[model samples]
Target chain A: MRPVADVLIVLALALVAASSTAAVLARDPVRQSTVLALLGLSLALLFAVLQAPDVALSQLAVGSALTPLMLLLSVRKVRRKGKEGGSHRNAGNRTGSTDQEGRR
Target chain B: MNGWLSAAALLLLVGFAPTVWGAASGPVRRRVMAQNLATLAGCLVLLLLAQGYARPSYVDLALVLAVLGPAGTLVYARLLADELAERPARDPVARALGRAMTPLAAVCVPLVVLPLCVATGPGRAMVKLLAIGALLIGGNIVSTRALSARHATGHTPRGTGHTPQATGPERHTTGGQSGAAGG
Candidate 1:
């Protein structure tokens, strides 16, 4: 059982870590945010394995519920702002440099 | 008890960092959501540890943190939205405030943690409360500044659907703007 728990914990940590990396590397904010949600889910699983039931419950409830809702709200706001450089040629150039240099 | 809780707390902090930083170039709505989700997960971890320890008081504290974290993020987002719609260009006052708050907030973490060493019974609650208060207040102030900048600059829009054609090479600065445009 201890070994199983350890493996689970390691797996959970790996998943969360990978998703977090993806979240940072992802250029699309929407995709990044979604990946973040996945990271949160992995964290909750970690807590559950660590034997914190109440903590796991709160993680599921708040992490799964409120956070994503807020992200969606922000996404809507961005979409409403409309496409910045509407034309194709400029848009491609804009997003490309924006993604490359913008990433730290 | 301290060991497990501390580890859990550290994990929570680690999870929060990426989500927070991701807001700059990532989706605002999604980042906020991720922020809330991360907070919730952290809170849940805290709550679980508290339960195992049979500490109801800690549970209450976790509840407060969970609710406040997302609500605060939402308020900050709304503020960002309003700011973005109209350019409010950052002035000396805002910059000065950011500079002042950043260092002061950094120092508070140790102060918040110090109380835990001797924390016992009700005193422990005080320690936890102070720590939580610092985090919540600090997060609010910082996020508000960021939102103001984003609004002033029209950077950090939330959509991920930008086709390459819609983006420009000089959009790098714009990218910087979007990253910071959250509440």
Candidate 2:
């Protein structure tokens, strides 16, 4: 029974590691936003386990909600800019058709 | 090392880990569902943590998570409707989210809170726990419905069902503006 709590901390840490890596490695902006949200979740869990509830609270707010909001908003703005540029050139070009699609 | 801590750990491993993987690698809808699951699991884990560590104050963490988690997922669903509505991606994730919010919430909240209530002996703390559990389950249900609504309507305008050709960037721009307002 004693070892199990330690295992929890270890697993939370593992989750943090795996999710952070995945957040960076993710491709699509929308999907990456999901990974970012996951990263925030695990990180908040880690903070809670370490006995820092205050820090964990802030982390929960910023990590889970705000970060995803900011990331998705920025991505949306950039995508909109791209679409406006495309429609400028030719009305036929919709989303995912911009030449910059190969960037990331 | 206690029963609550052990339970929390086990729940995290079994329930939360898969969500991480699901959110990390999948289609947009799948990731959204996984993120929703992660929030539910995280809230439950925090409740266990509160009991495990013997700190009534810690339950506040779970309470806050319960409120904010679904809010975040709802925001994701609204903003990313275009991507999700691009095509249905066979969302087992959403069904899993329904499970997280419904049956899991039904099972875990009462199970933990009841015992915690007994332990706290019908005080203000017990009241707080009950309230948190209610809020968690209620918020989860609302968020689940909102997330799945786009899938139901196929993200098209209500009256425009007859015209497949009407889905141009202009329509999406209007949709995006409304979504931004909602966000």
Candidate 3:
């Protein structure tokens, strides 16, 4: 049981490291953030394995629930801003042509 | 034994894979959230460590962290929102605060190290201290940078600041006009 526990701990740490690296490395912000949320959930399980129910529950509440929600909110904010930007680019294209003709 | 651990470890892996992929990319607002996820995973690992050692203290720390986690993130998000909303003008105080963090870390290291060396030998307590310090510093940096960025970009979500309730795009036009006119 003890040896198995050690293995679980190692594996949990590996997952944490991998997910964190992904969160940091991913190109798409939304994807990265979502990955991050997943990482949090995984950590919650690891806590459970460690036999700390209190800590495990806290991980579930904060890491899986609250943290992810916050990330999602941030992602939504970014997406809205990006959509607004797309509109700006389209507007620029229309006005740009006018300026070009004026310059000529 | 292997049964519970296997399932738990597998879940951790599944959760973490995407986060690492994201982090490799440039830092962004979302990246901060992603890092938080990773931090949570680390916290879980710490919980397991505590359980394995039968230490009540580790569980207590985890509980504290769990509460702090969301609160800290929310604060950081608000700061980031502010940074994006503000103009490009940099606040000297913010810059100074940012610079101070490194020195503070340096000071903290010795304070932690001296006691750690005397009491527990080179063990789990050292790891705990490092984790705590990292989490706190990481949270602080995320908040401050976001605040500064929001300030420089003037790109915050609408309705963040206090003003009379104005609805729709027309409200922005009126509000913006008034703001511009006022300035």
User: Where is model 3 more than 4 Å wrong at Cα?
Assistant: A85-104, B1-183
Clashes of 1: 29
Docking class of 1: incorrect
lDDT string for model 2 (B75-105, tens) is: 8888988656654545566555644555676
Q: Which pairs clash in the backbone of model 2?
A: none
The residue-level lDDT of candidate 2 at A56 comes to 92
lDDT tens readout by residue for model 1, A1-104: 34434654675676677766766787764455456555656666566656665676676566544665677677655655555535454356457645744662
Cα misplacement distance, residue B152 of candidate 3 (Å): 42
Question: lDDT tens digits, residues A8-80, model 3?
Answer: 7676567667666666666654445546555665566466565666766666566644665676677667656
In the order shown, what is each candidate's alpha-carbon RMSD? 15.5, 7.1, 16.0
- Could you give candidate 2's per-residue lDDT for residues A1-104 as a string of tens digits? 45866787899899999999998898777788999888888998998888889999999988878888888899878777877776442233334433323442
* Fnat of candidates, each listed: 0.00, 0.80, 0.22
Error (Å) of candidate 3 at residue A42 is 2.2
